[model samples]
Target chain A: MTATVPGVRRGAGPLPRALHPGAWWLWALCLAVVASRTTNPLLLACLIAVAGLVVARRRGDAPWALSFRMYLLFGAVIVVVRVLFRIVFGGGGGETVLVNLPEIPLPEAAAGIRLLGPVAAEEVLGGAYDGLRLAAMVICVGAANALANPKRLLKTLPGALHEIGTSVVVALSVAPQLVESVGRVRRARRLRGGVGRGRRAVRGILIPVLEDALSRSLALAAAMSSRGYGRTGAVAGGRRALVGTLVIGGLLGVCAGLYGLLDGSAPPALGLPLLLGGLAVAVAGLAAGGRRVRRTGYRPDRWRGAELLTVGSGLAAALVMHLATEIDPADIYPSLTPLSWPEVSALPLAAILLGLLPGYLTPPPPTSEVPA
Target chain B: MARRSVGSAALGALLALLAALLAPLSPASAAPGLARPAAGSAGFCPDASGVTVVVDFRELGGGRVVRCAHGPQADGLAALRNAGFTVAGTNRWGDAFICRINGRPGVDSEPCVDTPPSTAYWSYWHAGDGENWTYSQRGATYRTPPEGSFDGWSFSLNQEEGSAPAPGLAARRPSDGGGSDGPGGAGGDQGGAGGDSGGPGAGADPGGAAGGGSSPGGPGDAGELPPDAESDVEDEEREEEAEEEPDEEPDEDVDDDRSAEAAPLPTEDAEWSGTDEEFEEQSAARDDSGGPSAGTVATLGLLVALLGAGGLTAWRRRRAAAASTAGAGADERPADER
Candidate 1:
């Protein structure tokens, strides 16, 4: 409709030109849903790929994207180190001997060296594949974060948790403000004198920062009270109590389901039902809470063919990867020792790449320098 | 578009890097000392035909020494006193003790008896000994010196003719119990001299074909007694039973076969060499794979990550919006500020 915001381009394209930030939750929720159902490598891979593409397409240039890419790198390092440490120290009889160092415990095979010392060819390849899958997951999450703006996202929050959402939203913003305030304090100090070395910088920074933070908090509290915040003047009798109980009970049920999953002995048939029931209760609580709040005009994220493709392609790719990849991180030994290279099916990769389409179309807000 | 492509390429590179790093850490096995039996403590003593006590020496710490863990043969005279077998001779040997039952001949000197074999019994006080003892089947021998006195023991039980069931006869269903036992009575009658001569053959008879020894009864037939072929047969039967259990799958055979084919079968009592260390390796591998319950954990982890990201991203956007509209809310603050 109205392109009030700069860079808000309009087109008759199938996908929503600008996805409401709230939709990011749907993407995350979808990942969680997929994860809960299957640990099948193919499914997890497909899920990760699709989410990654969505993230890249939406907000690849955002700070989150950069950190995510780095995170992937970090994950890879961890994999290599883990494998190396294991191969050198861990035990497994192997035939192909490498070095016969006295300290290393000879035959290389007997010293717990496989493929080679601290470096089995098979284990390395498997670890790398696992690392890729992990990276894909991180990127997907990063993309979601980058693509969605905060205010719009809060709107999608279940009404039952408005206060929680608001609190969380405020707390998160505090970090950047703290960073900005530090800059201001530094500037103020620089104008007077550089605080000439030796720990004075720490004192100069801390004192002003604390004073500003406290003053701001007081001002915020006073302002909120004058505006009648949290005073909706509704009768807080039976219904309120009932709603509160439902919310707490639903939360507890969700925790119980999680505990059952952790326990592992829980029957799938029973666990799934409990989990679903808990989710249903939670959704109901949200719906009830929304009904209590003031009425507002309807606004919904536009669903288009491209957006569907974005989500579908990602989901499909993950499913396909899971099915195709025989790489069970758990069964890494057999999977690695056998050393059969899983055929990297091109079609699924292509599908996952396609899923990144939406993220490309949706750009993030321009990064701006804040005034202290 | 070029920027976007670059970004995607960067993402791919990062994934590759992560894959590389994680490769080395896939799952390290534990040290050899810790890993347990590869097929898990099975082949050690499959089933109880004759009880096999594997001391698992590591389970038993050091200090107290058992002069002879096996039976009296290895220890001889000294072992009799150590085993509390009623010392019959002067307890002279510093390392050895000779003994005989009060009414019977000492096992060290007396010949192993024939029919109605003499039973050698011994009892020791709990005064000094803890519950550590090793007793081996008589025919089994120790290649190395015994760790301590009564550290382990081995012996045999010879029965009177027609009394004990023959080898493999014990395992058969009771329905198949009726059989000829010994040739003594039959041979006596066949002499055509005394038809009433009562012998072992007269008591129980399994025709010569069924109960025949591997070779016709030779001299000292009671001495060796073929070292009990029933033990091996019993082992096979137990394996069959374990496999047939509803809970156990046939896959166990595949593993056993693989083990048999892959490595040399470790001898029963040779230096306690086996794959207990492999258990720790398997466990560690399991840990890397994120364990059996990994899928659920991964899902939950993703959910938490998403929640954090969503909340943070929203807050950032809100702060921006609030900054842009700061002056709009400034004027309304007067009524509240007062």
Candidate 2:
């Protein structure tokens, strides 16, 4: 952009340009929604596999990018904890007893409550399925985080939301920076040969790390201010109020609209019309807000054909899943009592597979952009 | 005198209601002939007027059905048995598969099928208001059918067959009990099967056995045996059961709770002596057929996949860290030289 060249190529191949961060987020959200539609472990497994494959293939070599494994670790912990809770609470109904804990008979007052007794296989299974579904959604979010550049994503936000977006980008960068600071302090202490045992070790590492963090944060704040962080030009008070009202009102409308959109059982009056109204109000708010904040752009990101294709696949997956719920709600939470194969429809399954389209169509992240 | 009689009658009725509520498993005094206490469910299907039970003798060439108001039976199996279907089962898979209906048993060609069944046998399903059938996960004895729906027994020949096929024959429409009293349940006369044993005590009985015993013949000959020989066997069994029937002795003392509870009609001990209380105790029963949840198996696979991906990521991170540290050492030497 500084060189004033259009479509400049560093390499001769198609894999030179990085994918739009919006595309990654949109793709991940679509896959997460699909995971929510079914408790069928088979379908959920397929979904998790798709997400893992895509994230692995597309993620760049960045500190934030390395955090996806931590998400998986969190998911495993969630599943194990869920199963453990089931063992503790659920029993009495199912016949197949895996383990029999001591049955403490409560007084008649606690009629329905059972404590540490036989753990049923059915309960454990149900818990695992539920936990897996939730973990899948969480990891999908993590995948979006790993693959998308937080700073790049902040740029794509509407002007009205820029301040909020910037703060979020800063907050995300803090954890990795803190880890780097700790590593540096530890190495310095080792070189000085003063990392004493117990209390002495704590004083050696803790004070320097805290001091470093404070100084770095102050430096960052100074840099941001010098670069004109909040330099919106003087505006009429009425216009400011109107802009605030439009954004606030638009946000409330969007929340209500989203509630209606996600819940199919909600009334028609509360659904499509409200969602459309919210979107319209939000757009108007963004346009008004964009006028006041003036900043030089080094080449605004383009919404290319590939971006549309990438996001569309995800949208299609989510939309098809919502459609599937309307068609047969039973297919979602498959019953264990009857012991039949959880119904997996061809259309929804195909849509879930289609969600993987972004991995192929978008250009892979170039190694040069990654920090050494 | 009229006032006193009314008071006594009311007290007796109150005592009966009190006993019924207290016992939870007490048969209604109004219909004594209905042996088992009926557990009432709010019938969901508004359109369905009355109960129509269909019995399908799959691979046995024929089946039979009985139409009745929701009657007294301990559970669904007892309900079918009281309706005169000779149901058979092993110690395992309680009522999962009905081996016999109307004396026909499963053979080499035909098996008593279970759904996702290991063998070629029949599976029982109860249609609870909905058109779709629920394969009974709980034993029929534990679950009663919501009235006005169909309880079907279908034999699955193979694993791949369209599951839970309805009985071949249509359920018979409700009968008017005709001349032969068709289980009209003449509660006082205590007629029907038990009355057919015709003791001299029953002959002198004040209430006439008015209704005829009008049970339908099996569509299959049911291996028709000589009636004379069968009657003697039935008579011996009935006499033995009659001895075991409750309300045998009425106590004069009203204060004893046990006497009040045991006695069906304290005023008339004579009637209960002949009345057969069909209380089939499901003795020494344990459910043995359940397996590990199939969905859990799939989730375990999902968990394994997540762990594997995580391991790969960790391995790559360690390698990258090693290379970067080695380079940092090289860069430190250059800085010292400069």
Candidate 3:
């Protein structure tokens, strides 16, 4: 009889490795940029097409990835419901009245209610078009994720960010380890008959999770020191550095004050300044941070031409979306009123989908280096 | 292949529908009639100078035409007669007259109203005749540069039956044949410089009587015309010609060819004189017309799109689950004992 060893595996099946995590990040950025701009149907539809092309190229004819029957059925039902809802409750400047619902009165109430509809054709269709674009974008993103592996995500980080990257990777591992520790503690508690109720289980879980996390953090600190981290003198200080710090701090304070004065989501004048200030502070901090260890020897992998293509495609999609869509935040949801549904529908969903495409073609990390 | 085909087909139909639906409504694709201004602009905003002129036109239509100083021209019954316009109708003491073909909507310039309307509406004078009066009780004082001399001017009412007069050109005919030629009057008819009243002979004969008294000074003196006098008719003929031809430029760009006229204040001896909102309710009515609460369209679209995405996700999940189940079932077998 053949024996099976059960544990977490290093790599997924060879069906087709998912795109790199960088691609997903790019997709997210593109979505944000595209959403800021257009709701035009034509542009969105084109984006959807590009997303499809990406899917096709990444995964070799994965039939289920771009499933249409389910999507269409869902879309049709939603459209019908939306149209009916709008008809019943007047909206979108729809004036054509096809029928009215019988009035229903609350007993002894001053007001009674009746429903109204067939909303104008323009509003219904316009709403549906927008819905379609959003759906397309979402599907493309999902397909990209499903096809790409998460294990290789760290490969994309810049070498300068190795410590932060390592921290993040270790931090990610903590949750799973905590879960395992909790299970062990629960089992031990059960064996000792010390926990019986749901409350006991929560106590059991929390204690072990926290203890494990703390212990792991201590061990991490020790391991980092032993490995000669910060050997490159990243934190050497001088008066010039102090002056730089003071200047940056003062500028940041001023920016913070201005931000408080002009605080609002839609005001780019305010947001842009804050963003620039924050970026400057971050760059300064990075510049001033303690050194990288010479012996640690961590380096970001060179991006291949194929990888560049994937990233470039995502960037292109994002740029195009920014150019094509209406960037006015007001258009998305007008203030002091119910949200602007019609305008929201006009978002370039298809363009977002295209932007999601590059993530699909990104290469996954080599299976050999994956921690088991 | 079938799935791909279905996806592509649905995408195509969706795209085509979107394209067709979007053709006419975008600001970029505004209706041709209302298409003069490009996107994001109401057009232009004129300053106080423009506002003053519009106010002047309103005063003129409101029959507030008082006699006042105008530039350069001599004043007399003959001169007054030379500046006549045909009144279209009489109502509420104000008579509407057709403006010349090239006549501006009013003195207001384009700068007075061109933004897309943080607050809606651009203020400009529209020259429709008849009882559509824009009333202003602004009286005789007008602001002028500290160093400039004021010219006397006269205001009149005319009713041109079929056609409008040329802008700034009025026809005046002296009742007593004081002999002022039309637009470019000859030298002999100069009754007086400035807006002085005509001589005794010119005043005694009703035929030569000036329509209004001597011109008054200041800005509020923009509109003052006597109801009972006819002036000379020289420029009036040229106005008729100008009216016969259609204006080359758009209405917004139309400019006045004649100098602005302000009527003189009446002389004490001169006889014959005459002499006018529920905000909440209005707002409610306008609000009702404003159409559709926010994000209704977007929510509807989102719901539909999400439903589509969710359905697809579920289907894929189910299919994968089923395939895994099938494979597991097929692979399962009694442990082999060797």
DockQ each candidate and list the results: 0.02, 0.03, 0.05
lDDT of each residue in B154-245, candidate 3, tens digit only: 23223232111111201121111222222222211322221222222222223211322222332223343322222223222322232211
* TM-score of each prediction: 0.47, 0.56, 0.38
lDDT of 1 by residue, A320-346 (tens): 434433332222112322222222234
Model 1 per-residue lDDT tens digits across residues B215-240: 23321133334323343334333332
For residues B193-303, what per-residue lDDT tens digits would candidate 2 score against the true structure? 222322222212223111111113423223322122233233334443332222111211211332223322221221111111222122113122233244534444543
Predictions ranked by lDDT, top down? Answer: 2, 1, 3
User: Interface RMSD (Å), each candidate?
Assistant: 21.7, 22.6, 17.9
Cα lDDT for residue A37, candidate 2: 63
Off by over 4 Å in 2: A1-13, A263-272, A326-330, A341-343, A368-372, B1-338
Error of 1 at A351 (Å): 5.5
Each candidate structure's count of clashing pairs: 61, 5, 86
Alpha carbon lDDT of each predicted model: 0.37, 0.51, 0.35
For model 2, what is the alpha-carbon lDDT of residue B228? 26
Highest lDDT model number: 2
For candidate 3, write residues A57-167 as lDDT tens digits. Answer: 343222333343455445444444654554454333222222455444444443222245334433444345445545645544554554343335664543445566677
Error of 2 at B313 (Å): 8.9
Indicate whether candidate 2 or candidate 3 has the larger TM-score.
Answer: 2
Residue-by-residue lDDT tens digits, candidate 2, A1-372? 111111223344365455788888888977887886676655676676667656665677676775676676666667668777766655223323457888778886765456768865445555666777777788788889888888887878887777777788778778878877777777677778864889888887889889988898899989998987866568888987888888888878888986676543355677678878988898898889878876565677688877888899999988887776666554465543322334455566676778777755666565532324
